[model samples]
Target: MTTENVDTLEFNPISAASRNGGYVALGTLGGKCVVLSNLSKNVVKLSPSDMKEMDLKTVCGADWCDDNYTYFHPKQEVMVFDLRRLATDIIRECQVKGVYVESYERKSGVWLMPDGGLAVNSRKLWRPDGTVLEHGIHAERIYSASGDIGFDLDTPAANDDEVQCVLNAFGGINWRNNLGAEMLLGWFGVAIASVAMRRRPHMLLTGAAGVGKSTALEMMKWLSGKLAYASTGPQTMAAFYQALAGTSRAVILDEFEADPSRRHSRDTLEIARMSYSLQEGDEGIVRGTPGGTARSYTFYSPFLAACINPAKFEPADVTRWVVLEAISRKPDAVALKEAEARVIGPRLARRFINRWANFQKNEAIVRKHIIDAGGDGRMADTVGVLLASYWTFVSALPATDSEAAKLVELLDIQDRIALHAITDEQRCLEAMMSKVLPFKFMDGIALVTRNLSIAEAIQRICDDPTGNLEITMRLAQLGMRVGCVQGTWRMFVANSPEHQELRKVFGGTKWASGGWSTVLRRLPGGTEGTQRIGAGFGAAKVTIFNMPADLLPANDGSALLAA
Candidate 1:
């Protein structure tokens, strides 16, 4: 390679083979490999031609099949080379230095790394045509060759008694209104049993303080076989991954705190996102041969679950996870007292262990529903399953109006919060209206007006009369004579009953010419003669001549002025 191009080439040493006085293998810039060695302290590069003269017995190590190794060095970047093609002329001439290699087997048209050794980097498992097969970090190992590697899952006999036991352990006392807890149980119980359609069915349980989230998780643990529990925090990624390695179908991540350093809550949401898919890794092995001792690693299972407080989670998190909110309220004090007196935790656990099979069957049904719904079904169904499963736990709790309303609001707000499409003031007003308004107000109108439209008008009315009176006095100011006269209130616009009715409604009066004279008398400018002339009155009771209907065209003249 040219000197300029050499800068881009990466080299890795195959540690296991090289440590045994073997030729150090190297991966080329273009993902090819070569071997290098030191002969009498003079660094000697070994090409494919050199390999023919060298005895296989004399050589400490040789790049067998590139498929057998993957390279990952802490200092240099990682790459994979196909040793099966090592005899090719292109690979024969390449200088392999600072390059590492790992073995892989082509099985079912897919390349798989051997047992006891995992692919150092998951991205290397791609098709010969360069299509990436795996995209994320391999957090779990799947061992196909090791018959001894197995998962321990509890298999309770399938029967109604067992089912009831599991249901009772999951807090399934009754079915009505225990939606959240029931759904939680279905998800967790089925998930622990490894019955989820997807390899990973992450459960997220959130609720207010003093609610039984942690306690419920503890109960689940007692119901299942040995489970690994990890308490996640802002810096728990390493710990979380490490803990995930030890378990098969179940992992309880408790007290997960959303890192505040992020712009949003749930700093490790990215990790949570990846857990939806399965990952592969290698397991280490120890073998002794006449040549020397060898160590290898392989891949194994993927299944995990997590629980977090709602305050520490973002709305977007609720979408990816099966979310269950726990409410702390005792529906029936007497029943709760009796259950508490009975020490039901152990009874519940016993029931769960008994009905584990039915839980698995029901989980299968739920998984089919999820698949039928086409990848992450609507949030309601996802949450509904959990509520249905844990129904008995919260059934005895009396429902509070505030709690019910909060649940409804939470459901509605999720769409907005998840999408970030609502204004802060609108959210505030919703809270206020929900608390203060007796009658249901139009949410659309409230959103459009921002609660300020009517609120501002009302405030002004209570603040100043002159400014406020304009709202009530606009019609009278529009040249409509409106007031009381004699014993009745009247409003006259061309001396019509329509005007009179309007007058009654508005509490006003109107007359032909006499009323106009009475109003003018109260005005700044008025003369006795002018008043009498304007009034046209000649009797004890004020009277005025009614103008002919068409004396002045209705369109052009005021009937009072014409009279």
Candidate 2:
């Protein structure tokens, strides 16, 4: 009942006071029943009701330190200190020698390995416990299976025939390099890049059902072990936020296709769009409850998917994946069997990991080289790691490796691909915008105006010619929101929820939108605003873009799909 009997009580008064350099006693000092003091800190005397609000009994340090936060476990368990938020004391009592309170807190949602690194599974991370899981989902760290062997190319050296056989099943060495690079990313993607460079490209194996798409993914599954997952993968943005609360390397969304039966596939496509830029600072907010656990979850993970036609994938999402179409369209039964039999799965996986790790070791040098060779600045690390992965498998003999020499060549191809894609997209956008700018809208219904009197939106470019690309780039920057207001598309820059302008434009509007940055798009009949439209000219799905207006389909303007 009194501070004098603190030793007899479970709470250690001396330790608590020492931690914050303050005295917390149940004796009146300011005409109050309790006195709490810290060195030149806030002095608040809590009455009985106020004590409950402060959760006083749980206070270990000062009156209110880290009282509200619940830390994560490496295995995705949500937990808190035994004495409310007094993590230090509980960790001290845990008697797990050498483990700090922060270590157990899993603040990073990643395992800070005792070996001095991090472990992530299923894009999920946790506090390190000297072990990591060997399988994805529900499979926590495989005890004693130190990431020592699993994430490295520790396999016995295979002969050319053995390696070539595996290569053949994966569409030969050409496909192998690209696929192998992407597959290894499934394990280390989230960990290797900084926030700016953290986008981990996904993988798509497209082929007829029996063409062995599953077999290719199975090969990846073998290499990845616990990091390869086959679940639906954060089915909704809310679920995506929840998923971010954990760790993972790669996720598999199999048989990926837009559900033809549905009116729209917003959930599916939004999830796909998200896969491209699921890093810490991306725009999507999780949990409807603002400023809650959603604040703690940041999304980043690689995806490996198989589908007949990734009909639902957007061009933006398409670029985020390394597409590998099955060469044997009629179902390569032989190749399927070979891939599943672990012919080169184990060795190839090892080599990829080891080489990728080596690239990371030489990250500075490799990154410089890629940039010098004109690799896309945004994906420099990606190209460097991919080239390193290719060279590692091409030959152990560095001198004989044309693969290493091809780093420049590969990067050249990448630059060309990027340039070509951008050029094509710009042409398409110009055509669409040409049609769009002259259109007249009343009550949000869009119709082409007979006269070209309304200033062409192209004037936006003439004002700041550079601004056109800036606007275009911003549109494609991972999570830009182009909402459909009635049948008209508006770049929903919900210019800050605090702005009266935003409230005026978006207030009570039932718009189906993604991220607070977007205005929620409201469809007729109270439907959410996601739709599936086929993208042509090799685009896996339709995308918002910038280009020459002359190239846009004469009849198509801004709709969810071009078709």
Best by TM-score: 2
List model 1 lDDT by residue over 1-563, tens digit each: 11112332222222333233333333343233433431111123344444442332134233432222335545666655433333342244344234332222111111223332112112133322234333221222121111111111221223344434444443522222344444444554334323122334456566665555565665555444333343443434444445443233355656654545553234245545444433333332224445353433221221223334343434344454655555553453112232341333333433333343343344345434433433334343344234323432333232233433433343343442343332232332222213211112224335122323322322322333233343223322222222223422222222222334223322322222223334333322222231111123222222122222222233322322322
Q: Over all chains combined, what TM-score does candidate 1 have?
A: 0.35
lDDT of 1 at 242: 52
Q: What are the per-model numbers of colliding residue pairs?
A: 62, 46
Q: Rate the local accuracy (lDDT) of all candidates.
A: 0.34, 0.40
- Model 2 residue runs over 4 Å out of place are 1-163, 172-199, 207-210, 232-234, 237-244, 259-295, 311-319, 327-357, 361-374, 379-384, 394-428, 434-563
lDDT of 2 by residue, 1-563 (tens): 11233221122233432234322332332223332233322223443344441344433333334333334565767654343333333233322222111101122223324353445322222222323343221221221112332332224434556555555555522342344433333323332221223345555667665656676666556544544445542255455555543343456667666565653345545554565566443444344333132223444556667777565544454455566666553344235353443444445444433343343444445445656655555444444544444444555533223444455554455543563254223332322233321322222343333323112433332333333443333333222233334543333232234534323333333221212332122111222333322112121222232322332223344222421
**Looking at candidate 2, what is the lDDT of residue 209?**
59
Best-performing candidate as measured by lDDT: 2
TM-score on alpha carbons, each prediction: 0.35, 0.46
**Local distance difference test, candidate 2:** 0.40
Q: Each model's RMSD to truth, in Å?
A: 23.1, 16.7
Candidate 1 regions with alpha-carbon error over 4 angstroms: 1-159, 172-177, 193-196, 199-201, 208-210, 232-235, 245-249, 257-267, 277-309, 329-381, 384-563
lDDT of 2 at 553: 29
